[model samples]
Target chain A: MIITNIETVPGRTIVEHYGIVQGSTVRAKHVGVDCVAGCQNTFGGELKGYSQLLEESRNEAMDRMIKQAQQLGANAIVNVRFGTSMITQGASEILAYGTAVRLE
Target chain B: MADFLFFVVFVTAVFFIGQHIQKKHFASLEAREQALLYLPAVVGRKVFNDDDVERAWLVHGTVVVSGDYFKMMLAGLIKFFGGRISAYESLLDRSRREALLRMKEAAASEGAHMVVNVRFETSKIDGGNPSQQTTGMFEMLTYGTAIRLKAQ
Candidate 1:
């Protein structure tokens, strides 16, 4: 699908605002990874572990948001945005939202 | 001398255990990417209620990173590996996913089956100070069109 962050897609026109649609997910660190992360901190580098976890969560959340929009039968989403909340010291949540609309 | 020898062995064992745990942790994270297939499909659809026939929407993404512990660590790792600073992958991935969903929703709403002329852009939202925080915050954005698939 055509995706962009710009307010307007060059060739397409936004028809109507379908209100706000969103999807989100929360994640916590497991003991296995936390223990290792604690030690890995000593050497201090990219925790490929945590990074991948975040990536997975983000994708899931986005997918859900898209489904919600589809259910609404919007031809496009405009002015889309993402927000992240640190739920706790070891956990965080990612949210995706956008304005659903029809395009010509 | 015997006591010293036993202490050394114990310490060695603990060290190995820690290493093993760390290795396992890394392995688990790597395994996560495998389930990526089950991730939701990105889709968006829109219908123009107005008379304008040239419907279009803009999709763009920006990667914002604030200064923090995680940001520094990531930067250090990139430097250590002689790799370019790509601390924005997380943001990019997030944006891309969101943008796709938005597009899908828009398309589905308009009874469109596909989107076209997809494009992407990246930018910085905030340039936080490294001295002020332990980690950095950044953003990535993605946007695109939701179009009807041409009739077969």
Candidate 2:
């Protein structure tokens, strides 16, 4: 499917509007990679382990969101948004959401 | 002298073992999952507005150390092989799942079906500190258009 951060795909026209679609997942430090994170404590040029964990979580949520849209019969989705939060002392949650729509 | 030598050997062995496990596990899991998409022309012809779309989705997920025994085994195999590529694959699979689910929900709300020309992105959060172990994690984001296919 045509996925983009932009509200609309360049040449396509939206026909119908689906309310809102979302997918989310929660993760904990014990289940994640062993690495140090946060902007304040990063070593020189090395990539932090937490950063990698967040990336993985984000992708999983996006995939689920797309699958749901397809099942709803939407040809495309618009106005997509992403969010992150600390669910517990050592865990985090990632969410993906957008409006499903039919195109001309 | 013998004590010092043993310590060096022990440390080296631990490092190698950790690297090995990481390689083995990542490779197995990454290979098992693949991203698939279905885009039909009827849905493709619609003229969609970028701004009308409104929001940009940020999809994310994690396998975690505590869940899925099978996945943990796979990760261990990946670690055995060496390199950090396995980590990327793990995150990629998760991001794809999230993006698709969100798209489906959007389509349902609009009373439409199907999404076309799906796109994906991957990035490292770079929390910065290598010494800090509790706050590190990777992030992935996938975005795409949700549309209704024309009726036959």
Candidate 3:
């Protein structure tokens, strides 16, 4: 499905709107990854493990949102947005939401 | 006495090493930005259509950056004085630029000419209690729709 973070997808017209669809997931890294990240923190560099974990979780959230839009018979999603929050110490919740619409 | 000595040595090492790494990162970010200057990324929300557009799709980049203990402690001291914590400024700037550059690179890799409606999401990830530890880090995510024009 076509997705854009604007009101309308480029080169496409929205013929119908299906309101808002959202998906969210909370995730954390394994102990080993966390330990590695902790060691890397001392030198102040990129935390690859955390980055990968968060990106994967974000993709999963977007996938769920896209599935919801697909179920709504929408060919595209627009005005998409992402949200993140720490649920606990290590776990974080990633959210993807957007308006589902049919394009012509 | 040994504990205090170790603390001083560790802080000194982090200060010099962290500053060096940050300078290197900035230099690399500048070089990459110049190389990718041809690809325009904009945050305009208004929709505009180009008749020559061939395809459009969403692209994103994510980065997690950490701060050294020296900066973290400096920020703490500044907090007591109720002034700006400038030490963390570079950390934030570095991550934002890195994330945006990565997004532009992704669009370029897809052979897209431009990225529009760019949005950034930033969040702190301490991984544990903030007061108990001196660690500081954040994640930055930038995304937009990459547009490829029809070849003439």
Measured against the true two-chain complex, the DockQ scores of the candidates, in the order shown, are 0.11, 0.10, 0.68
User: What's the CA error at residue B121 for candidate 3, in Å?
Assistant: 1.7
- lDDT by residue (A22-98, candidate 2, tens digit) is 88888665432442323212211122365455667777887788888898888777667777666655566788888
TM-score of chain A of each: 0.87, 0.80, 0.97
Best-fitting candidate, scored by DockQ: 3
lDDT of 1 by residue, B115-136 (tens): 5445443433223344543343
Residues A1-104, candidate 3: write the lDDT tens digits.
99888777666678999999999999876899878988778778789998899889999999999999999999999888899887776778999999999999
Candidate 1, after superposition: displacement of residue B45 in Å?
Answer: 22
Off by more than 4 A, model 1: B1-152
lDDT of 1 by residue, A9-101 (tens): 555667766788888999876788656654443333334455556557767887787788788877666666666666655566777777777
Query: How does the DockQ of candidate 1 come out?
Result: 0.11
Better of 1 and 3 by lDDT: 3
lDDT of 3 at A79: 84
